[model samples]
Target: GSRQGKDERTTSPSSNFLLSHLQSIIGSPSFPYSSNSPNSLSPLLFLLHSFLRICSIPTGRPIRMGNACGRGKRPAASRDTSARDNEPRVAVNENESDRERDEKPAVTPSPKASMKRSSTPPTGAMVTSRTRASTARRPSTNRSPNASRARDREKEREREKAKEREREKEEEEDDPIQKFITYALNKGVSGLRAEFEELRLKTIPTKEQCSVFHMVANAQKNRYKDVPCSDDSRVILKELSMGTDYIHGNFCGTPKNPKRFICTQGPLPTTIVDFWSMVWQEGSEFIVMLCNFNEMGKVKCAQYFPPTQKETFVAGNAVITCESVAKQKWPGEVTIRRFTLDRIDVNQKRTITHLHWESWPDRGVPPIDATIQKLLQMVCRSSKPAVVHCSAGIGRTGTTVSIQIVTELMDSGKSMETGLGPFLIKMRKQRAGSVQNDQQYVFIHRLLLERYMSEEEKENAKFVKFAKDYDSFMV
Candidate 1:
């Protein structure tokens, strides 16, 4: 019983504490407390009555029981009169009351107010109702008609544009040209070969078909004119940084990787300076010379680099020196000549790996050559773009570049069928007349097919002896 009594005393609000708290609320000048105020004191008196009832004390009498009220016990007076006399009250003037009420901000109910409000009975007052209503009716700014309409229109436009895009995408999915391209790209080497054979026997690029303006205008001698290097994004001499004024070579690379090749024509004797300048400017590490110095008794390409005996040649501001020449082992299918090109003006030197595929006749395919594949591998491994060129830099050059791209794509896990056609199209866009004839196109397809073959499939006993003879022809 003693422990229970001590617990009650510890948990209950001390009389002094309650008295001081009530004094603060009633004493504040800004508080809307008034003795004459009917509803205000009703709530206050009701709360005190509830507390006294909880203490198991009589509630009808005003009693001073805490040390905080200046005396320890209730004064000997009647309950109602003492309650009114001792309670702190502030006087109010009608004018002062109006000003204070207007200026005094409404008090927001604390989180504890809800629990406490229900714990006590209603005091016949509207204090709690007004607080809840003020919170519920929090002010918000109004929007103008134009602003609201603009927002609605913006949302409507977004929805409409989204629907329009969906329709366009559906139309594209149904497009015949897009379907054909998609079909062609997804083909394996075998399918590509069959397609090429069909095209070779059936199709040709007529003059009327070649309508692009720059393509028609930049042709050389009108004979090799269709294979003009793209002038718009043509490779510039980095040393000079002069745009499109130097060489007839355009920067052609895969869409995923753009700095892959400088597709250009075989350097003419007169254009040798520009060619070397391009190599140095592009930081080209490999010079893929696809044609010979002469083909079918005609000088198809200039002897751009000096031979073994004559080790040096000067071209424009650069001096070309043969560093080392290694001919592909007997039946030399490809001759690899390493040259150190010295920029005389800048006193800088860079070594260029020159790959020469000699026996590929003009507009004709050589006997299945492994040397080209070897060259492609070397180019793929190199960090810089290979400067690739043939007699016109379109036929043989196109085939070789296409092979390199297809092989690279295949090695990267892309299906061979989808990459070659798009690669050839992109190549021709950069340098016109690429893969010029049906034969060259077929050669590209055949090259990719050979990669897909088994060793047994490649080993033909019928041509076993011809292979030996072919080596002699290559040498």
Candidate 2:
């Protein structure tokens, strides 16, 4: 009964003075005991809070030094200085296999002699102190300035590790499309054998499809940017940071200049991705095409230049987030699903906007217009414009946007020829460093014709084929 009572006393909010202090600092929104908090705060923690506010410092961020509220089942507050000094050396369970490990932060007890208050040790009487000391409050058992910071550093390390994992995954996502496009360029799009001719026939190693599954492997610690695209094969996996704000291309393509790189989250220009392409896809005999899309299904390149730029009214654009749900079975298998990102802002210069396609899915997976309509409806009450892109945003991204554009114009009673000519000219100027190949030119043109024309017509037409599912080749 005494042990149980002690346990209750140890775990309860009343005992941990630091928890009370943290509550005053972070505030009562999360706690039941939250009082008229500001009125209750001792002038000290309030001063610290004010200092943080003045610095424009993020208070809750792991990098910052802030009081950490202890959570979970609390151990009975230790008495006896020798016992405290000789804290058990519990073996870490690697995973949270033990209750104690799960409940407490890792702290190896120091081998140095016990720290006892020279005059009066933390006695049971002090623990049950009925009177508050008038002279001064002695240090508590839990007092440690570096512990919270150490925990913060550990948490920060975990955050960085998770971010690094995500980037490696995204690069992995960019891999297959990179390989397939490279296969088309080097081996020619005729067969699967050509996709991985290096491997034995019928032995389709998943490694050949690394581009398909970026999250293929659970990364080992300290491994950042694992299994990246070879330099020459030209894979440009453009990554973005979070947020939905209007970004204009006043000055494009400045890496070191810093001022040149301004947009957030959507794909960067083709110039940037293309510049890195040679480095990302280096070793292969032939050049590979790049696949650069966002967590959302829409391509970033398409978002940049648009007849397809999405329109919004009550909503600004789609805010995006993603998680890798599919679990891979073998050593190297990835399970990731991408989603479209929210648009930054509306172009006041244009009366209307809709998603356009510079290139369409080679598999004819789904109509770009239909997909755009569905995504736009999700973003705003009505459909807004959008564009699709792969790394060399000019090619695939431009083409997908162009295809969607053609259909939109046709809906407006504009002829295919009229839309096609003008759109291509603009694409050339928009992405001009490299040669926009004839095959890519034809690919977009075919997709434009593919959109208005029936599926039966596509079936009847010979020489090319489309896939049955989203598992089609274009992915």
Q: What's each prediction's TM-score?
A: 0.50, 0.23
Query: Across residues 1-475, which tens digit of lDDT does each residue of candidate 1 receive?
Result: 2111111111134554665476565545566653333435645554574464356432233333221222223223223344354333232222343446446444444445653555432444345675666655654335667778999999999999999999999866764433433443345334555665554344334444344324433333222554544545466565442223456676777634677888887777667777887787778899888777877788888777887734898888888888777778423378888888899899998888888878778887765657677777787677788889888877888787777766656556554334355566556666666677655665565444455544674475422333343344334
354: Cα error in model 1, Å? 1.2
Off by over 4 Å in 2: 1-389, 417-419, 427-435, 455-475
- Tens-digit lDDT track for model 2 on 276-382? 22112221111112243442475433233211123222222323222112333222222222322333453222122222322334323233334433332322332
Q: How many backbone clashes does candidate 1 have?
A: 4
Give each model's whole-structure lDDT: 0.60, 0.32
Show where candidate 1 strays beyond 4 Å. Answer: 1-223, 238-246, 330-332, 415-419, 455-475
Deviation from native of the Cα of residue 228 in model 2, angstroms:
25
Considering summed lDDT, which 10 consecutive residues are worst modelled in model 2? 243-252
TM-score computed on alpha carbons, candidate 1 = 0.50
The stretch of ten residues in a row with the least summed lDDT in candidate 1 is: 2-11
